[model samples]
Target: MDETHRDRDAEGRARNARPRDGLGRPLPYGTEGVGRQPEGVVRSPEETLREAQRLLDGGMPFHAHEVFEDAWKSGPEEDRELWRAMAQLAVGLTHAARGNAVGGARLLRRGAAVLEAYRARGPYGIGVGALIGWARELAGRVEPPETGAVARPAGRGRATGGVDAAAEAPRLRP
Candidate 1:
């Protein structure tokens, strides 16, 4: 067998080895590990927030979802809702990437609702509010660019506004 074939088999084996969870035992993606944050480590919410934003901005919504999930797990249950909303938004984007616009919209709207609730609670309200708007905009298909141009694959690295990526995404009904 060729080295490429061996590599593919190894990858398949590794994927098969991962443990499953209640949700069909799907393996967690992106994160190296799961742990409750320990003592003596200074936490920077802004950094955590920024990292999530950066992943989303760079078009790696799956990774972004993982980052926000970590943040959610580390936070108090009350504050966790905000992070959960963020994580859900990332997941929505991932669904969008997979062409599931309807699934994405459902998740985004749910997250936005959670974010709005958090916003009314004060403290981290401002941050949650900002993201809520973003989620709403995404769910509603508001233009991502001011010029109404959403770059889409023209063939390879090239892209054009003629193709509506948002419109092309799959729409799933509840």
Candidate 2:
């Protein structure tokens, strides 16, 4: 075995043991990190909404993304679009937090488009129209700057648009 052994979950799948910041950014080994969402849990739409909202409220878009991802993967085919859209929005916020303006804006817009399809018949008491508006608003807010423009001033390092995840997150329930 090499000195730099890989981390593996109990099921023998590769998992990064490195700690992560609140936004899910990996930190150096031995640093303290927030709790990560476990992978592969099946959740009802309502449950997913509650849990994802809790995570989002705590400025943990990346973790909320995982929750939405599990919903996307595990949800019924009829509703996969909704869940996938939710996941995309969460990840879009994650990108923003990571200071990837282009990616953040793009994903935010994409998620809005995807979620828009559900406006008429969106399920689970979701405020589809409201959610769409929220996504679009965030997308517009995080839109990439003009050429040579910067989202943040220099020397600020990476901004926590991740924190914006909490400020701008949509309320799935009416």
What TM-score fits each model?
A: 0.55, 0.85
lDDT of each: 0.54, 0.79
Count steric clashes of candidate 2.
1
lDDT (Cα, 0-100) at 30 in candidate 2: 81
Residue 127 local lDDT, model 1: 57
> Which candidate number maximizes lDDT?
2
Cα deviation of 115, candidate 2, in Å: 1.1
Model 2: residues >4 Å from true position, as ranges?
Answer: 1-4, 148-163
- lDDT of each residue in 71-127, candidate 1, tens digit only: 787776766887787778777766655555556667878888877766755443245
Error of 2 at 157 (Å): 15
Lowest-scoring 10 consecutive residues by lDDT in candidate 2? Answer: 154-163
Clashes of each: 3, 1
Candidate 2 positional error at 78, Å? 1.0
List all candidate RMSDs to the true structure: 12.0, 4.5
